[model samples]
Target: MGIPRTPVRGVAALAALAALSLTVTACASEKATGGGGEASAPSAVGGDGVKTGPGVTADKITIGLMTDLTGPYASFGKSLTQAQQLYFEQANAAGGVCGRQLEALVRDHGYDAQKAVAAYTEIAPKVVALAHVVGSPMVNALKQRIETDQMLTLPQAWATGLLGSRAIQVTGTTYDIDMINGVDFLTREKGLKSGDRIGHLYFEGDYGESALNGSKYASEKLGLTLVEQKIKATDQDMSAQVAAFKAEGVKAVLVSVGPRQTASLVGVSLAKGMDVPFVGSNSAYSPQLLPTPAGPALLKDFYYMTAGTPISSELPALKKLAADYTAKYPDTAIDSGVPAGYSAAAIVVDALKKACEGKDLTRAAVVAAHRGQSAWGEEFGTIMDFTTFDRPASLLSYVAKPDKAALGGAVVFEEATTSDLAREYRVPVG
Candidate 1:
């Protein structure tokens, strides 16, 4: 929907699936394991209506991922795919899911909607489930298809409607919920009193539109005024749009655009002397976007929201995971999207672990085993919880700002936020 930023870009280059039936009713039929535990790997049944991956075997479990690796969002796809790969490598190093190595069956869609459909079609019948499918539209394209096949599609992008379906699970806060949280926190904690105006600049797409609507809904709930601007994803210049917002004299700006466009907006905003603090959706926060002169000027007063726990948080377990990740693949960015990818990938590992718990790996048994599994407290944060019932997750999010410690010259944490209205600010750390 929006331009692909680093996180989105990485996912684009790295990850696929086809149309699955939306029918989510659980049914059971007796099916035998292929052989003794090691030889009896999971197999696809006949010419399938949808795609499926080969399942649990004595040695490895094949989990498929469809991402935007080559087309519009290649950078995002690449980063996300690397993240998943690293996580799996780490998990594999630790003996993998349920004593079986987790092997990712990744396919790239180049962020094309049709390609995403085709990718899903090819991978559906081969893997146990789809792990960390990126993009709002790409995932949207295959939602019903995944459902019909009864394959759980753990998503990295936030599209709230997917929450109501059985086949899709999210790793972080929904767009609406994250927007409301940011809006509420800004007002309640940051002291943005009534009468203050906020401006929104977003590209026109499902990603941007969802963000716009979410911001609108939050603005109404928070009793704030919102000025809107729409930009084409292909538009590189934002001087005119910045001029309009500057003319309005709003106190803050909320941006939802890809890295390239976001850079253009920041450049235009700074050139125009519109020093109002900016708030952005997940799209704007990326290490690749920063590191230029434009980064400091535009991002200095910028605040963004995210659906995952920061690597900087003082959680011992998560810290250990991060440390291990760093020790192995010293080059991964491990920023916002990477953690989201890891968390989503981890859940698939959980599912596989459950599927292979007591019996040999078989399609029928793996599907049956995962029927009512709940990941309510795996410790990924409030955004990712699974239950056999009841919305599974709290859908919480955190407010973060840029810092020096984050990878690629971008760091984020709650301790970095500031409110220009109240004159309250957190200490800035390099």
Candidate 2:
């Protein structure tokens, strides 16, 4: 069954939304720390507190990371590991942070919360803070403990429920905020008029649940009708859900599963003639996931949001980072998680550089520096900001599509559109 299509206009509406987002983010930034701070260029260290070069010396500073190196999100987790190792390795080669070399102690929790807790405690005393943590539950399990102990956590994705906390730095827009922005774009820019039926195909977990809830909240807020489908991360079958969406006549679908599951859902949806465009958070938007058995066929109209520009040759920062990474680790591939891992590491390094201001590199000093500093990095279109109370101030995401021609015959990478709808939702900066 086919549904009535609503004609949408984009050029002007998207531009207006972008301007509005910038203003809102600026107001939030002023509220975050009360004043505009100076913006720094490419150097990792900021101000006088930061030790130049790879300053993570054995006695000075040690960074610990808890990741799912061999679990459900292992693919992304592995890329994160590579990013961290490669970033620190380069930092060390430069000189080190604060004249001290950066040291990263990473452990695998298999994406298990209990195991993550155990690993957190085990790694607690060894490092200054936990940086670039991967999973929602794992981070949730350790949030209180990290806060109580006054440690820094750079969570890769955004969750609004995580706001107003001290121990974390969110990399993207909050789930609620982002959903609202996405809905606004769909309705206003994409002409997804009011009363349009929206669909959700989410995994059955906290991560999925968060996205689902956010989607519902946004839909209801914007007067959009909705259909819901729940799947497990382990589930390989999505025909039933695809059928349901088709029958319900959903105009657009919001998916919250990982890469494999997302591909499966898209595959079934495409094969069954379900042409509804699907939108997803960062988790579902992987270059590696798009080339699986039934990937391209399913993800034809697939669009997902990300917090950064991603690693494209067009972005000089990303280009430099890619060059650095390739020089350091010649065998690895640069996928979705690689840039994120670098950004996450960059956030932590920014904080540490601030924290190390005018003092010997110590955990206490690092924590203090993070608390006292106003913001990190130039919010140059990326969601990297922080304050004393608002740990994760902003998030940035982009819309990307599979590039069959560019990736040779494989079509393993996602090429970004010049104006991604996701950019309209950037949490503004002052």
Give the least accurate 10-residue stretch of model 1, judged by summed lDDT.
Answer: 20-29
Instruction: Give RMSD to native, each candidate.
Output: 10.3, 12.7
Task: Write down the TM-score for model 2.
Answer: 0.77
Clashes of 1: 43
Q: What is the C-alpha lDDT of each candidate?
A: 0.60, 0.59
**RMSD after Cα superposition, model 1:** 10.3
Error of 1 at 121 (Å): 2.0
| Model 1: per-residue Cα lDDT over 258-367, one tens digit each | 75566667766877788777777777666655555456654577767766666666656557767766775575445565566676676666666665554434444444
lDDT (Cα, 0-100) at 196 in candidate 1: 80
TM-score to true structure, per model? 0.78, 0.77
Summarize candidate 2's per-residue lDDT along 189-233 as a digit string, tens digits. Answer: 466877889888776756566566667766776688979898866
